[model samples]
Target: MEIKTIGVVGAGKMGNGIALSAAMAGYQVVLQNRTAANLVKAKNSMENQLQKLVQKNVVTAEESAATMARVQMTSTFEKFDAVDFVIEVVAESLDLKTAMFIQLDTMCKKEAILVSSTSTFSITALAAVTQRPPQVAGMHFFIPPTKLVELTRGYYTSDETVNQAKAVAKQMDRVCVEVKKDSPGFIANRIYTPLFLEAFKAYEEGLASKEDIDLAMKSSYLPIGPFELADIIGLDVLKSSLEYYQSELGPSWSPPLSLKQLIRAGRLGKKVGKGWYDY
Candidate 1:
């Protein structure tokens, strides 16, 4: 299927990044948020990012302006009617995502491909709640949406759905990693979550400071340390994912006490100006 127009639900960091990515790739993007304030924030964030791209010479000023022109921001699903593709990038709550999926199913055309950017949720479960299972799949983009896009097929997702998602990813100039299994966390998080948990455990046990632990990992093979990554991801988000992992896997996957305490204290990470480390 030809995906010329893309709709991104939610306009926070991830949502805006996805909108920017699609627009940069020449797709007309309708970025939807929950409120007018969010729409304004998303627009400002996209503009700032475009300015950075222009400054870095990744794109000329004319190209940046054209890309910005392609993205339309909204606070409702009105634009989704003509959208050929819809991606829900809402928070990782299952109930919230399911609700959004159901809304997308109702608002979009039957042939419109529906995708979720959830990192640790089941695409199968989300698809089951929709009327168009064959058109539903997982297109998990990394936090920045500039790294890799994971194209995944749920239990009921069709080959056509998978292929169309791949095409969409290629159009965005992203490297595609096909996730065969419909399991929670897909591929990256299966490896990532363990490393994150171990980092928390190590810190909680006083084996190392968060700074030193992150330093060690970065010194070895990673671009950033686990605690630092967790902070960027939001401590609340990491704790929530860890809690989900514990429920799905076992008690051993329970979130560390240190994480819970930080969350309880409202230190949600860089967005909030505090988390594993102060920003």
Candidate 2:
């Protein structure tokens, strides 16, 4: 199917970025969030990001305006009935995402493709909740949206569905890496989780301060340190991913006590102005 309209559920960081990218790619976009406040915040955030792009000469003012014009923000899932493609970018909780998949399955057109941006969950499990499992897949985009997108297939996902998703990713100018297995964390997080564990262990063991560890890793190869990246990705999100990994992978994937303490204190990273480092 030829996709022209894209629907994104949730208006947080990843959701807004994905919507903006689609709009910039010249697709009509529907960005949905449950709350009015979040919708407004997402609009403002997108506008600011576009302005930055304009200043950097990455996009002209006219181009930025056109991109914004292509996006329609809504608070109801009913608006998604006509969208040709829908991406769920809600919190990384199985129950929450499964409920969303069920709703999308009911609301979206039969030909519409449904995908999740979850970093560490089973695409097959989510597909099982919907009747249209063959149309379901995982399209994991990283925090801040690099050029890479991990496209994963569930047990029931069809080759046609994967091909369509890859086409959409290509339209958005992203490079696609197909993941054959329906494994937890897919590829990126499988590698990243171990790095994160070592970082946490080093800090917990008092080998170095978080700042120092971050500084040491910030080289020409890696633009951001693990702690800084964690802050931007949100500590709560990190903890949740770790918990999910621990359950599916092993005990080694468990979150450290210091991470839990920070979360318990309500420091959820840059979004909240506090995390491993205060903003």
Candidate 3:
């Protein structure tokens, strides 16, 4: 299907970046959040991103404004008319995602696709909850969609839908990795989980300080090590992924307990200005 208009389910960093990229790609983006407050936050964040694009000369100031103008912010499903594809990026709970898909199946056009930005969870199960399973698929973007290297596919995704997503991704300058299944931790998460867990395990076993481990990885020419990267991504997200991984896999997926206590105390990562490394 040729996508003309795209819809995003959440307006957080991931959703907003996806929406901004869609707008910059010259597609109409319907940015849907549950509340006016969320819509406002998205708008402000989007404007800030656009301004940065302008400052960095990535886009002309006029183009920045025009790209942002292509976005339509709304707070209800009623605004989703004519949507070609919906990328659901809300909370990662399976029940909530299934419920949202049930609602979306009724609301969107018959041909429109329903995609989840879930790192973990069964897309087939999610599709089963919806009326149109063929139209339901996983369109997993990485943390930032604009910098997307590739996205994984769900087991049940149709060839046509996958192609459509691939074409859209290419148009937006992204690579696509079609994963075989949509189980918890599709592909990247599946591979990343063990690496991150081992990092936590290293800490738990008293191998070395978080700083030294990170330094070793960086000095060894790896992108970023576990603890430092976890600090970059909030501990809460890791907590959620760990729970999902543990539930699906086994004890090996267990995150370090200290990480949980930190999250419990509300000291998330970079967002909180504290983690294994202060940032």
Model 2, residue pairs in steric clash: none
Per-residue lDDT over 114-143 for candidate 3, one digit per residue giving the tens place of the 0 to 100 score: 888887778888888877777777877876
Whole-model Cα lDDT per candidate?
Answer: 0.89, 0.93, 0.81
lDDT of 2 by residue, 170-258 (tens): 99999999999999999999988788889999999999999888888886356788899988988888898898889998999999998
Pairs in steric clash, model 1: none
lDDT comparing candidate 1 with the true structure:
0.89
Which candidate leads the pack in TM-score? Answer: 1
Winner on lDDT between 1 and 2 is 2
Model 3: CA > 4 A from native: 144-146
TM-score of 3: 0.92
List CA RMSD, all candidates.
1.2, 1.4, 2.0
lDDT digits (tens) for residues 121-205 of candidate 1: 8899999998999899999888634579888889999998888888888888889999998987889988888898898889889
Score residue 165 of candidate 2 by CA lDDT. Answer: 97
